[model samples]
Target: MVSGGINEILRAVEFILSKLLSELQSEDENDVEPKTKVRLIVPNGSCGGIICKGCATIRSFIEKSQAGIKISPQDNNYYGLNDRLVTLTGTLDDNKCFNT
Candidate 1:
């Protein structure tokens, strides 16, 4: 049961990230300012129980949280589709994530 719950959380995180990236990529280039915020929230309760669970379960969640899109600042890559979306979506350091 614990493993399944963790999997769901991992998937949720990925879905949120993907949406953020997509939103960042659809902005107008001529605009002077981007107006969007990207936030990810992982509840403390999700990570609270079952310390004795298998290593695979723990590792999977950790890996998913660390997963992120990599953007290149050169070649105007920062203005690329995904990059723009990310910019409009704010950042991971915004109010999306919290450590409990």
Candidate 2:
């Protein structure tokens, strides 16, 4: 269960980073890193909660709340086809994720 949660978080982060990279590509043609605000949200009523290493907070939330991890393909119309554009739609504890 813990491993599964870790994997889910990793996958979500990866997807987010990919989108960020694509967006940054259209900026000025310089080797400068753009500053951006990034947030990770997991359903379990942990919004605004402090984040730490080892993911003890999220792991504990999942274990105690019995929340299930859900992932789906979200279309952003970038590919002009819903099926071709894939993004992560994750929910935990009956709430829409990425709220934070």
Candidate 3:
């Protein structure tokens, strides 16, 4: 369960980094990095999710990343499941990530 959360976060980070790096290689580097988002279907209230320790861990990971990432619970639930949709939006600067 915990590994799944970690994998989700890793995928989001990879997607964002790849996008940022591609922008860096382009001719025009002035454009602001577009906001990136990752959605997940997590357990609902009946499963003690959306506020469980796993969710808290995800929040912590975002906070510690300091990459302008935000995670929030959406209003809608997953299709045909007792799961919820969670969105992880990122506003991290491309230069901050690729200017090394």
Best by TM-score: 3
Question: Which regions of candidate 3 deviate over 4 angstroms?
Answer: 1-28, 45-50, 53-58, 67-80, 92-100
lDDT order, best first, reads: 3, 2, 1
Q: What is the C-alpha lDDT profile of model 2 across 1-100, one tens digit per residue? A: 1235877966766566667656765564464544444333333223323223565664555555444432233446465433321123222222223323
In order of appearance, the predictions have TM-scores of 0.29, 0.32, 0.40
lDDT of 3 by residue, 1-100 (tens): 2345866976776676677557654735565655555565665663343345757855554555544433344446556555665665665454343242
How far out, in Å, is residue 53 in model 3?
5.1
Return the lDDT, model 2, position 90.
23
Go through the candidates in order and give each one's C-alpha lDDT: 0.40, 0.42, 0.54
lDDT of 1 by residue, 1-100 (tens): 1235866866776567567545655655554433454332323343333112664544553454443322123234435333212212334433233332
Model 3 RMSD to the real structure?
A: 6.8
Candidate 2 overall lDDT versus native = 0.42
